[model samples]
Target: MDTIISIIVPIYNAEKFLASCIDSILSQTFKNFELLLIDDGSQDSSLSICQKYQQNDNRITVFHKNNEGVTAARKYGVEKAKGEYISFVDADDIIPENSLALLYKEHDNADMVIGNFIEVMPHYSKKNKLYSPQVGRFNGIDYISLQLENKLYHAPWGKIIRKNCFNDDIFTTPRDIFRGEDLIMNIKLGLNIKDIKIVNTIVYYYMIRPSSCMQSRKPTLEYEKMFDRFLMLILKRNKLDTKLKKSILSQRIDALTGLLTEKIHLDKNDTFVKMIYSQLKISSFDMRQILLKTCLSHPSIFNILYRVYRKLSSITT
Candidate 1:
C-alpha cells in the first residue's frame, strides 16, 4: 500500500539527536506516512539506533550507503519513496505531532504546502517571527519572489511537496556544491510547481548546534563561487517577471555582502578575499552601482570601510 506522505531524513553522525527525531515522527498525529532514514556512512551509533527503530516499526525503512553528501542521500531516498507527497527532516530537528496532519489537511489542489518553523538554541528557543503569507494559495512566481525577498524561507525541511513536481532526470544528478544546495533545490522545485499553499503554523523545531556545517567558519571560496554561478544560471533560465528577477538579484547581492563582511578582517592579499572580490564584480548591476558610489572600487578599500563601519556601529550600540 502506497503511503500518503513520505518523510526523508538524511542521517550522518547524528547519534546525539537521532532517537529524539525518530520518536517525534513516530508520535505524529498523522500516522499514514512512511519514514525513510538514509544513513550516509555514519561513523557513529546512528545506524544502530535506526536499526533499533526499524525493528519495531514497519513503516520505518533504513538504508545504509557510502559517505555521500546529504544531496545524494536525499536523491536516493526520493527514488525509494512510494508516497504521493514528500517531506524532508534534518536528523537533529524535531517536528510537532500535528505537523503532518496540518500540512496534509491543506495539501488540496496545491503542488506544495509550506509551514513556519521555530529555532531552538542551546538554552533558549526563538520562533521565526517572519511574516508568512495568510493562509492562501500562491502562484509559483509569487512564491519564488517571496522566498527571494526572505519573506519565505528556502530551507527544504519545513515544506511538503507533491512527488509529481519532481523530474527524476534532473533530481538524479546530485549537486556537488554544499553551501546553498537547499536554496538551489528549492528554486528548481519552485520552477516546476504551479500553485503552492502557505500555512501560518509553526510545525518544525530547528535545532541550532555549534558543530553544524552552517556554523563552521572554514572558508571555501570555490563552493561559494559555484553557488553564485548556479543562482545566476537559474535566473537566466527561468522566464520570471521583472520584479522577480530584481528580487533574486537583490538576494544574491545581500548574501555576497554578508560573506564579504565576515571575511573583511582577513589579509587583503588572501586567495579567498580575491575570489570574493571577483564574485562581487559579477553579482549584480545594483551591487556594482552601490560599490561605485561608495568609493569602494577595490576590494581592499571595501573591506577596510566595512570593518570601520562595523566597529563604529558596535561601539555606538
Candidate 2:
C-alpha cells in the first residue's frame, strides 16, 4: 500500500484565497494523499467552492460543520483522517507544490518533518530563512523548546506528523484561548515526537492580509487566559532553562502592554497583572526588545505614538 498523507485545512469565510489554497495542495508532486477541507460554517460562498472541487476530485473530502473555530475544525479533521501521516494548511495560505513530497520523503524516519515558509504580503513577498542554507534533524524536545521561546514557529501548518504518535487527548484545545492555541498544541504534540526533521526549503506561503484581529481585539480575561496557561505550562516544568524563562517574561510584558495599548479598564491590583509588572525587571536590552516587538506589531506613526502614550499614561502618578 502507498504511504498516504492527509492534508487538513480548516476554513471559514475565505472565498478569495480558498481556490488558490486548494489548487496548491492539489498540485503537489505527491499523489497518494487525501485533502480534508473542514468548512466551519462559513457565511460566504466557501462551501460551494469546496463542493465544486470535491465533485471532480476523489481525494477531496468536504465536511460541513457549525461555526466552532479553527481548533475544533482541526480536531474533527483528525478524527476523520485515514492516512499514515498528517499535515495542516490555513485556508488563506498557499502550500508549495513539492511540500508533501519533500515531507513524505523524510516521514519514514522522523515523527515530524518541518519545512520553511514564505510570508506573502500584498505587494512584496519575503522568503523565510529559518535556517541558513541547509537541512537537519534534531530531537523533538529541542524543537519544542525553540518554538516555545519564539525562536521557531509554533504553528502546525508546515509540518508532517506521524499519525500514530498522538493519543486522542492531544487534539483537545481550550475553546476560549484562541490566540495561543497553536503554540499550546504544538508544544503538547512536540512532546510525543521523538525525532524531528527540518528542511530549509520553502513549503508554505503565509498570506498577510490587511485587516488583522491582533491589531484591534480588546483581549479580555478570556483572551488573556492563553498567557496564563503559557506561564503555568512553563513554570510547571522541572527543568526551566534561562532562555525559556526570558520567553515567559517577554510574553507577560507583551500581554500587559497590549492591554494598556487598548486602554482596557481593568483593576490595577489584579493579581495576574501585578505579578507580571513585579517580575518585569526591564533591562536596557529588554527595553530594546520591547521596542522592536512594538514596531513589528504595526509600523504606522500614529500607532507607535498611541502605544507610547498609553504606556506612559499607565505610569502617571
Candidate 3:
C-alpha cells in the first residue's frame, strides 16, 4: 500500500544522533508514512545504522549514494518517494510522536503546512534554548515578506509540502548557489502556489551540535553570499508586487549588511565582496526609503544603524 507521507532524511556522519532520529520517526503516531534514509556517503557507522533500520522495518527505504550534499540527497529521495505528502527531517534532529499526525490533519486545502520547532543543544543548556519570537498566519504573496515579517524561517524540517511541490521545475533545477537553499526553494514554492497553512505546534526538535553547519562559528563566505544570490534571483524574477518588491529588497539589504560584516571579519577580499558592495550601493538608499519596513521587520539592525544611516544619507541626499 502507498504511504500518505514520505519522511526524507539525509544522513552523513550522524552516527551520534542517528538512532534517536530514526527512532523518533519510527515512533510516530501516524503509521501511514515511510522513512526514506539517504546515506550521503558517510565514512562512519552511519550507513550500517541505516541498514540496520532498513532490516528492522519494511517501511524504511535506504539509499546509498556517493558523497553528495544535502540538496542532492533530498532530490534523490524525492525521486523515489511514493507518498502523497513529503516531509524533511535532518539526521540529527528528532520530532514529536504526534508531529506528523497533527501536520497531516491540519494539511487541509493548503499547498504546504508549517509548524514550530525548538532548538535542542547537545546537553540541556540555557544558552541553546532559543524560541523564535515571531509566529502567526501569513497572507502575503511576498516570500521575502513572509521571511522579513517573521512569518516563516528558512527551515525545511519544520514544514510538510505536497509531493507535487517538488516537481521538475523546482526540485530538479540545477541551482545550488544559495547557502540558504531552503529559503530560496520555499520562496519559489510560495510564489507558485497560493495556499499555505500554519499549524501552531512545536513539532521538530532541532539539534544544535557544535559541528552543525549552520552553527559553525567560522562559516565560509560562500554561505553568506547565498543571501545575495537569493535577493538577485528574486529581483530578476520581476513578477512580484510593489510591496513585495520593496520588502524583498529591504530584507536583502539588511541581510547583506550582516553578511558584509561577517565577510569583513572572516576574509577581507573574498570573491563575492565586490559584488555585494555594488548591491549595497543600490539597496542602501532604497533601504532608507523603506525605512519603516526594515525598522519593523529587523529591529536589532534598525536600532543600531537607523540613526547613523539616516544622518549620513540625509547629508548625501
Cα lDDT for residue 41, model 1? 99
lDDT of every model, 2 decimals: 0.76, 0.74, 0.71
Winner on TM-score (1 vs 3)? 1
lDDT of 2 by residue, 187-220 (tens): 6776678898887778888877754324544587
TM-score for each candidate, following the candidate numbering: 0.79, 0.76, 0.76
What is the lDDT for 259 in model 1? Answer: 56
Clashing pairs in 3: none
Q: After superposition, how far is residue 174 of candidate 3 from its true place, in Å?
A: 6.5
What order do you get sorting by lDDT, best first?
1, 2, 3
Indicate which candidate wins on TM-score.
1
Clashes by residue pair, model 2 = none
Q: Tens digit of lDDT per residue, candidate 1, span 1-317? A: 66999999999999999999999999999999999999999999999999999999999999999988888888888988999999999999999999999999988868899998887776445544333444678887777777676667778888789988887543533355545666667777878899999988888988876666355444444555566666667767765645575576556545555655665333335554444444444345443336532533455577666666668645653
- Give, for candidate 2, the lowest lDDT window spanning 10 residues: 126-135
lDDT of 3 by residue, 233-293 (tens): 6646756645565565455545545543453342324555443333344354455535434
TM-score, cand. 3 vs. native = 0.76
RMSD of every candidate to native, in Å, equals 5.5, 6.6, 7.0
TM-score of 1: 0.79
